[model samples]
Target: MKELLYNLLHGSSTIVTPMDALQNMVIALILGVVVCITYRITYSGVAYSSKFNTALMMLSLITTMVMNILGTSLALSLGMVGALSIVRFRTAIKDPRDTTYIFWAISIGMGAGSSNYYIVIIGTLFIAATSIAFSFSFKKDNKYLVIVRGTNECIEAVRAALFSIYRPCKLRAETVTDDYTEIVYQIKLNNKDQLIDYENIKNIEGVSFVNMVARDGETLG
Candidate 1:
């Protein structure tokens, strides 16, 4: 077993040495952790999925393993490809940012597995730094799913109040009752002054209830 490992790592007719493989994989793991951290910091609660987040780390690890195995062997590469062909994935990612992170994880793994420590270290650092910077720089839109119950005539008054306070809003749902009407609006606000909006809606005549619920980036539809 030792001899086989030695050959795989050292006695190979390849550019990567035993030390190189070890360093590569170790760096891959480190970079994988970095990627995970970056994802955690940058992730918005919108459509949050713990499983998908965990898969980013796995993606880095597996890609590293695959690249290491295929290092200098065309035949092994073909076999790996054939083996991987049988695997299937059906889960849909709701966020495009998630896909970008997944691809970044795989790229980090591939670079590390091939003993490109510079690429792994520099690229991972750059991406992670960028993520951190962006997290601080760009804020997610202050979107809210506002639900209101009032008389039919009161809706227009409420809408006018909302329009003045918030940017254009999309009406997601509405229901009419004998005595009152319920309306849901997806609105984005420039400020986090939700209390003011609620107060405005409540002050409207015929308005019975006003609820403003913060929402993560899920579509209004």
Candidate 2:
């Protein structure tokens, strides 16, 4: 019984058994499932791509399979790196959060593929917990980005009124024309709903038009 238990625990390196390979594949599959679910639940961006999420699961499995093959030979490791280096990614990822998910999927795959099952499980749980904690603890601020196009007559008054309501205001850009001017301002507000009060600003003595955009910016949309 002692010899049998010892062989079971220490047999991975010497064992070319189908069971061992199947075990590794199963671990990779479980890790991929976890990664896919986490990516789905924690996603908060403007546009969610099911295709990208599916890719994350497939990447986890692919990384695991590659690592398993590379583990058997040093020559394969160098060749694999060369082969992977030749591949170029041309997709433009506009959202930083998407990049984070990609990295997380890769990390989990690498960990499980190398037989570090404990690390993969523990690390993923820690990350998921931290993300949930941060989501509840952090409150998104109310802010607006204002773009104005008008004659030069009431530009100063508009700026003054904006500065009075918003705490930190920045003049992003300005373009002057023969008869009109285009101005953009990054404005943070005490109350987001208060932006409705600014409709009258356009009706002000010489204001042309006032446009308000949420400060969250564009993401993956």
Which candidate gets the maximum lDDT versus the true structure? 1
Q: List the candidates' TM-scores in order.
A: 0.72, 0.71
The C-alpha stretches of model 2 lying farther than 4 A from their native spots are: 1-19, 40-47, 93-97, 154-157, 160-172, 198-209, 214-216, 219-221
Query: What TM-score quantifies how close candidate 1 is to the native fold?
Result: 0.72
lDDT for position 196 in model 1: 66
Task: Estimate, for each residue in 35-130, the C-alpha lDDT of model 1 and write its tens digit.
Answer: 888888887775666677688888888888778777876657668789879999887877778889988988998888877788778988998999
Note each model's CA RMSD in angstroms: 6.2, 6.8
- Look at candidate 2 and give me any clashing residue pairs: none
Candidate 2 global lDDT: 0.74
Count of backbone clashes for each model?
0, 0
lDDT of 2 by residue, 31-126 (tens): 677777777776665578889989988887888777777665545666888999999999999888778878888887788777788998898788
Cα displacement (angstroms), candidate 2, residue 176, comes to 3.1
